[model samples]
Target: MDAPPDIHSLLAVLDRDEWFSSCASDLKLALVRDARLLRCLAGEAVYRDGESARHALFCVVEGAVRFSSALHDGSPSLLVYLEPCHWFGDISLIDGSPYIRDAIADVDSQILCIPMQSFTQWLDQNPKHWRDIARLSTNKLRVAYQVIGEPGALHHRLARRLWLMAHGFGSRMQNPSLQLSVSQEHLAQMMGSTRQSINAALARLEGLGLLVQGYRSIELCNLENLVNHANRLGGE
Candidate 1:
């Protein structure tokens, strides 16, 4: 049994986050003061695709959230997993549109929910701060573009994905843990490759001393080497 997250620990994680770290103390307080922490068990839906808009901001404080969607035939498609200190629900928050993807808990997780009403009142007074909110969505959009446009062989793509996940998809944490909590099946879904193919790629990476695969997890042994391999083998 793990202990529940405390405010002190939560603040520490926010300090490491790229966007939150740069925010003014008042802005940070404004966001955190009225927030409520919600605990979601594994395999739960934080929010589903095409659901009516419930405007709120969210920050993952513990565990991971899976962003997924459905195919034409209604098959599920896993996009990526977001870890601690990652903010989401911004796209819908910005445009006032319904959520486009399903946000599901990949594990038992703690998430901070800030109602839009509170922020809406604040933003009405401080409209300039809307840019800060935009930054959150745009930062994620940048990562999405990188992932979608990533080119190369399956092995190369896998290496880059491992590196990106370890680094929080370019969020640049002060201290990034190299361990990734995701199964090969999830990886296959993310990379649009078969699970067997992902297994082979993982074996190749493991043989190269780049990573070690565990049960539902992967430990990046050499981040630099992994990126190098991806760029070298990942053709232009």
Candidate 2:
């Protein structure tokens, strides 16, 4: 367990989030007034699949959360790692459904949580928000379809996955470098491949002069190359 954030700090974090920016002014005030700041330490579960809690949406304010599920044998399956300012939990909001995956902190983290009712009130006035939700669902479905339809030639898939991770979750630094803080095994699971497969893919990418890999991370040396690789393998 972690300490809760005070109103001032929470408001500061919400100010930078794109989702919060899109919110109506009244909705923003309600969230700022009512949202709880939750602190989760590294490796702690924020929420698990198949459990009920106070209904709320979560936005990471600092650190990262790894969203994952389980395998048929009850082993863990890594899905996606969300970075700070990323929004999650709307699946529950959309259908009042239980979480299908676990949201675990990748590091000591703070997140803003707003009650489901408050979220609904906001969405009611901002029904256009549904379109954003639909786009998210469609993208996930597209990923699932790729996994189901094209199971081989995994190195290509790995390249595309890395491209997406860098573009989405990673940040560009002053050195003009882009990198993702992730484990090879986690990346492997996200691509529905094995750890060995992930290693091979990284080796391939490194050989191509696209990135430099380190423990639990990879720095993109040439982002345009990564983007072009993803596009070339886009159909994968």
Candidate 3:
């Protein structure tokens, strides 16, 4: 795995990230100066549910991260997969509430963290920046709504979810294939089904030449075929 990026590289990342690109010049510069980079290995927990959200905010600069939430008994389920340019934990920083989900690196990841105090002070100075955060949240809600439209046949639902995962989450691979850095159990939770069901769906997809499953990861072998299958279900 790579080491944390230097301040200069991280500053460029902040500038390019959709979540912060529209910030006022002063706020943007302050974020860059106050931020630090952290490198997380695969499967490392960036933050856990119910923990005090004291680590400020994390903007993914490389690789991917997954968010999950659990019941009272501690059984967890997938919430979302975040890619580079996406962020997590901002709500905790704003509302002083503990995070509702866990953030874990799906692969070796480089993250830029801004301390809560710095982020808060900058936002205070630029109250207009609040709109950007709101926009991000609204977009997420919109996507969630689209994804949750009346559940249907298992293969259709599984195909829809896989398509979303492949395109919604960014990757560094040169080929169009997407490597989901998650297991079948986690995917089962995301799909709201049992592991057996997910396994069956995966086997069907592989048999149809749409995917290639690996140990702890999955790759889409036929993007067009998957997209066609997903589009047959619903629009994103």
Candidate 4:
């Protein structure tokens, strides 16, 4: 795999991110100044469940992060996989609440961490960004609701998620591939199913020639067909 992009260039792209376009120039500049760039190898914990929500928003510069929550029995359940240009931890940052989920690097990942205090101060000074922030929050809530409302077939959920992921990350790639480096267990947790189910679904997709599964990655063979499957499953 190619080396991750430089943090400064990544930040420049993120600053012009759709979610940040409405933000004031000064506020955006301040955020860029306050952000800390960090890298983590695959499987490293960016933040554990129940950890203090001191780190504000995290913008994925390269690779992916898996956001998950722990069960009462301490088993982790995956919530979602966030990729480049997408962000996480904004809810905790804005509300002054504890992080409700853990964020783990699913691959060698680069991220920009913004401190909550600085984010809040910048927001206070630039009220215009509040509307954009609210829109972003609402969009997240809608996605969460969709995921929760449909907990049935594994293939169905995976299809929808793949579509979303492709739209978020693949739009920028010259030959976009919805390849994922995570395990079946993590995928099952995110889909609210068992590993067996995820395995079965992957087999089915492979049989359809929609995906090519490898030891460490899954290469999307037919992106359009996969998206069509998602649309059908999601009732879109």
Give each prediction's root-mean-square deviation over alpha carbons.
2.9, 4.1, 4.3, 4.5
Which segments of model 4 are wrong by more than 4 Å?
A: 1-8, 15-17, 21-24, 169-177, 231-236
Tell me how candidate 4 scores on lDDT: 0.72
Candidate 2 matches the true fold with a TM-score of 0.79
**Which stretches of model 2 miss by more than 4 angstroms?**
1-12, 15-17, 125-152, 169-177, 233-236
C-alpha TM-score for every candidate: 0.92, 0.79, 0.78, 0.80
**lDDT score, candidate 1, position 232:** 88
Alpha carbon lDDT at 107, candidate 1: 95
Better of 1 and 2 by lDDT: 1
- Check candidate 4 and list the clashing pairs: none
- Which ten-residue region of model 3 has the weakest summed lDDT? 168-177
Alpha carbon lDDT of residue 141, candidate 2?
63
Q: Against the true structure, whose lDDT is highest?
A: 1
> How accurate locally, in lDDT, is each candidate?
0.82, 0.70, 0.72, 0.72
Give per-residue CA lDDT, model 1, range 1-236, as digits (tens). 23434656677778878888887776787777677778899998888889766656888888899999877978668898899888888877787888888899999998888778887788779888888888877787887887887878889988988888888875664567689999988898888878999999999889989998889999999888998999885253
Models ranked on TM-score: 1, 4, 2, 3
Per-residue alpha-carbon lDDT of candidate 2 for residues 116-156, written as tens digits (9 for 90 to 100): 78667777888876665555455556645644554335666
How high is the lDDT of residue 198 in model 4? 87
Please identify which of the two predictions, 1 or 4, would achieve the higher TM-score against the true structure. Answer: 1
Question: Candidate 2: worst 10 consecutive residues by lDDT?
Answer: 168-177
Candidate 4 lDDT over residue span 160-231, tens digit each? 666555555322333344766667887788777788888999888788788888885677777789867765
Models ranked on lDDT? 1, 3, 4, 2
Once model 1 is optimally superposed onto the true structure by TM-score, how far is the C-alpha of residue 215 displaced, in angstroms?
Answer: 0.6
Q: Against the hidden true structure, what lDDT does model 3 obtain?
A: 0.72
